[model samples]
Target chain A: MSQVSQATVQRVTADLYVEVQQFYARQMPLLEARKLEEFLETLTEDGSIEHRPGGWKLEGRQQLLTEMRARRGDPEQPLVEEISAREARERNVSYYDGLVYRYWFDRMHIEPVDEDTLRVRYQAIVSMTDAAGKVSFEPTTVVDDVLVRIDGELYTRSRIVTHDSPAWADKIHNPS
Target chain B: MSQVSQATVQRVTADLYVEVQQFYARQMPLLEARKLEEFLETLTEDGSIEHRPGGWKLEGRQQLLTEMRARRGDPEQPLVEEISAREARERNVSYYDGLVYRYWFDRMHIEPVDEDTLRVRYQAIVSMTDAAGKVSFEPTTVVDDVLVRIDGELYTRSRIVTHDSPAWADKIHNPS
Candidate 1:
């Protein structure tokens, strides 16, 4: 294994920082547009996901699409995009070029299963705007475990996570 | 559309937690063991990785392998895993079943690009350990734009983010 010089590490780390910022600026809006096919294009062809319990665990683009079919029973309520924040860290770097990283979603925390995988988790307090643009708040949490691979390509094999359940009354009484 | 009950969210989130934890237990060992082929099984067949400048994108499993081959040139330095600390928050909930979440990883963070997608921007401080257990620190940051389709499936479409330049030393040392 090539010893990572202090200079090499700094350069790699800085490059990674800038890469993350660009993703948001260039790709987020398109996702929020619910351009399903377009959004999927952002990932590798074999990309997959697995959350947990009964309704988590999707694999491959085809399977992913099948899962999406189940979630978007109504196209109108398609998953929309909202920008909150993004972060990453190389928790540990071992001798053999292994890098463990963690990623955060609003209230979700994702760690790696290996050098090339992901695991997600979260706990959160949230605020939402209703159709009238009225604001509301709630507290919730989630934990997601995902596996990501970057052999020469980037793709996820597993994505398992947990989330809090919502009540019908909450949605009915306080509709977004 | 099915109204999401608070209970549903909580239950789902919890399951996600357990799944993620399990994944870590299973995956970390495999990686530290350097079971590269086994690790490959955990990724989508057509996965891709966006590593650095000059459009260093790797697509397909074989491509990923090539990339890894180029990096893991050292047999002496084996990979290792470490524990991670993280936090999460729900920023917004849309009437359209959209959720905006913010998750923090050490000093970095990732937020939802939309209900199902994520945007990440981050920098990190890594301590590198050699075969003799010598320790050194390296700072590497990554900005990732990832989108997850949460239809019983979780897959990332794209993760486009900037990273510190490989030639950062020249820039830093020379002050260009």
Candidate 2:
């Protein structure tokens, strides 16, 4: 790679950081809402994700959609079901009734790979919030992404997520 | 307060977001190194921190320096002590030796308080890494900061830290 001026690199990073944050801010909500098609739009058609520690790779947007659908289930379907009286009494209904999952990305570090592409690395922490207002955490992961500029907009070209614990791979790949 | 235009708000937020991130990026390292005086320099002379849930507050640079010194101990003092043979055998030496604390701030939301000030709110997660490479987390907190620009540089004027758990206030107030 040719050496770029330090001044130019700083300028690029500052501008790119804002754009990347905005892109993810818009995109992650779609995923949270299970708007799979809209979330897929944030990535290139040929984009891919590689989950480390398990060596699982989802190639192309179709595979991405498939994996996400499998994990999130069909949003169009009804989520809740009628429960038996005994089951309802046995379990803490409030805790399981309105569970929410949240993903937080932080400590972003950006590097310019070239004029059009950038490498961004960040730590992601996941949490589950129950209706009772209790929160539990999942193992943190480090995500490295390759983002490319397309028509002045940023899109993920590829992503590699490496979990802090190997046990997390089973949970992520299989869900519960 | 006069109503600012939406376009102007967007522009200001974009610019100020970069500035705040850069400011923290520089300031946090000084804090991690226990450079209390330098860290205080990043804040206004009369800056204050309010810890919610317990109503603990530290006002002014002098108080900040005192509180920080009390928590971090004197950095000039040597940290390690020669352990007795029995102590080394009974306790995990690697876990206590060379321990490091890290703070991560993310998901920032910026609101323009005025032409000269911005209210930025973000989540902060604290973690400790032991020499054995084990990592543990402290309670996550939401921090609201009022930042002001003085001659094109940003400085924190006030901060409010609200921990997710009330028990964490004890840890912050009296570190063990």
Candidate 3:
């Protein structure tokens, strides 16, 4: 059974799978930190993202980054502010504070297009930790997108996110 | 290069991919003809489908089929008539004769799960030939779904379709 599974992975473009997995891994921290500008840099110039269940859409990196921050706040009073260092793991056990947001991906499926492009889909979960570290979980979201390689770098060309519940921002930032 | 492509296929469970491709290929004719009952059999006993950009959803084969036909109308006045066949095709060429809706799939991507499951995504287009044989096209729709092998046969577990424009039914039956 293990051998068959390994064979399946070998048959699939495991290299590209690992590359994309790492891309998402790297992305989470940036998104968690509200690094919208950095995240914007990871998108193609003509990229567009549409979020259903919330009806929010952003096209192009410039506007995308601006709106991402605006959705958070006036930069100074952003949504969730936290120091993500090893910060005394002992002291970071509270679940209540300002706001907490974390995103993780699984059930990943990818289709390799040539060697420079990948069309990927995955399920993502959003978890929140308040200023005091009180945590709450949001429902999993279905994410579909295209990743393109340009000039030896990878960037997202398009993304469509569907939430199982309501808007992601509303669930996390404006908790009931 | 051919060897590499073949190797990728070998790794990715090529048999399953072929099965799913055939499934969708077979599905097109059934769907284009509005064979809802036959199409219902292609879904699992507990299947669900949702159409986005319009937020229409259906769960369970019974309700799904019922709502599908209901959305069209009573049996006498179906939204689309059959014409894929030759004589029937010729008889139904009048733009004012009846409503005609057709669906075609292309640019399909598949990922195999074990030996009996596949996650597939594809782009589909809808075209209609009115009673006068005047044909019009609806916007392309992005489709994503999972197919599971049940009792040695394949059945779709879930399907989500996102339309690029308005719904096909609205565009045709209620054309402006």
Candidate 4:
């Protein structure tokens, strides 16, 4: 990691910085909105994510899609009222209410690995706001991402996430 | 507002969108770091902010600087141990610990008010992360900003912020 940091730390151009930021801006919201298919499109066909704390990896778009689909459930199927009520009770919210998660990425440092690929490291803070408007944070994580330029558009090639704390180590579920 | 939205809703070019996002991306970190002088540089000399909930306005760079100075105090003067201890007690943190605020701006909608100026509206969510890593959110806000291009660089000419909820109406202190 140190060698990569020292040897390939190319200065990110102003244009490229903005382009990368915009890419995440568009991509993360799709995940938050549960637009799984759209979110998957932001990654390469062989894109992968490694959860360091969980010691698990999801490789390729098909595997990624399968995991995400299982996590998000079938969007076409409406939640049963009984299950909704049980979830509400478990979450301490009204029957129809749920948590809203907002992901904020900051302190981004970008380094060029090659002409087509860049290494991007950033702090990912996930804030869960409940029906009562209270916000709580998941443990902060530092994500190292490999982004590739494909025909002038940016896509994630791979991601490695390391949590800053182990409090939620057992709860690692999200791909990003 | 509707008239402006309807009449001037020009499609934001990819270049312009990236430019606008980049402008805020650079401008906001200055504020979080309490780099008031540098943050002020991102605004026009005659830039103004109107707090809709508070019904108070700070007009021009001088006034904005004065308010920020009061809020941040003199960085040159070190805080006495007694005062630091008191603040720690008040914030329920260790003697040297403090809260870190992260500002996230999202869901931006940009419209060309004219050739030289654009009206940008976005949701601003401020999260306060404590030393213990607990995060709480301030009431969300919708900020409408008028940005003008000066010598090909973007500068904020004016900002109007409307709180989404009244929870923090009386606690509004920061300029952004």
- Which one wins on lDDT? 4
Model 4 lDDT per residue over A1-176, tens place = 12333243224566787788899999999887778789989999999988775456888989988766655443234332333212433444322225467787875767777788988877678765654565656656668999999999999999998754333343322211
lDDT tens digits by residue: candidate 1, A62-99: 76665444332222232233211110111211111111
Candidate 1: Cα lDDT at A169: 16
Instruction: Supply the TM-score of chain A against the true chain A for every candidate structure.
Output: 0.45, 0.75, 0.74, 0.77
What C-alpha lDDT values do all the predictions have? 0.36, 0.65, 0.60, 0.66
Candidate 3 DockQ category?
incorrect
What does candidate 2's lDDT look like per residue over B152-171, in tens digits?
88889999987655445333
lDDT tens per residue, model 1, B1-176: 01222122222233343333343346334433445456444445665567454345767668767555433333353332221111000121111111111122222234444565544444322233454544433223354635354544444344454433332212211000
| Pairs that clash in candidate 2 | none
lDDT of 3 by residue, B69-176 (tens): 644332124234432222222343322224445455666777665677777888876544433223345567899988888655668999999888654424433243
Tell me, what's the RMSD of every candidate?
A: 22.9, 10.2, 17.0, 9.5
Q: Which candidate number has the best DockQ?
A: 2
Better of 2 and 3 by DockQ: 2
- TM-score-wise, the better of 1 and 3 is 3
lDDT of 2 by residue, A1-176 (tens): 34554644565654567666756655665665577787887789999988788657887889889766655543233323433212333442222223344569976777878777988899987764332223557688999999998765678999999989876633422123
Candidate 3 TM-score, C-alpha based: 0.43
Interface RMSD of 2: 6.8
DockQ of model 1, rounded to 2 decimals: 0.02
In model 3, where do residues sit more than 4 Å from their true spots? A1-11, A73-97, A166-176, B1-176
Q: How much of the true A–B contact set does each candidate keep?
A: 0.00, 0.10, 0.00, 0.03
Model 3 agreement with the true structure over A76-168: per-residue lDDT tens digits:
343433322122122332222345577766446666666788777665555666555555555445689899989877789999987543423
**Model 2's TM-score against the true structure:** 0.54
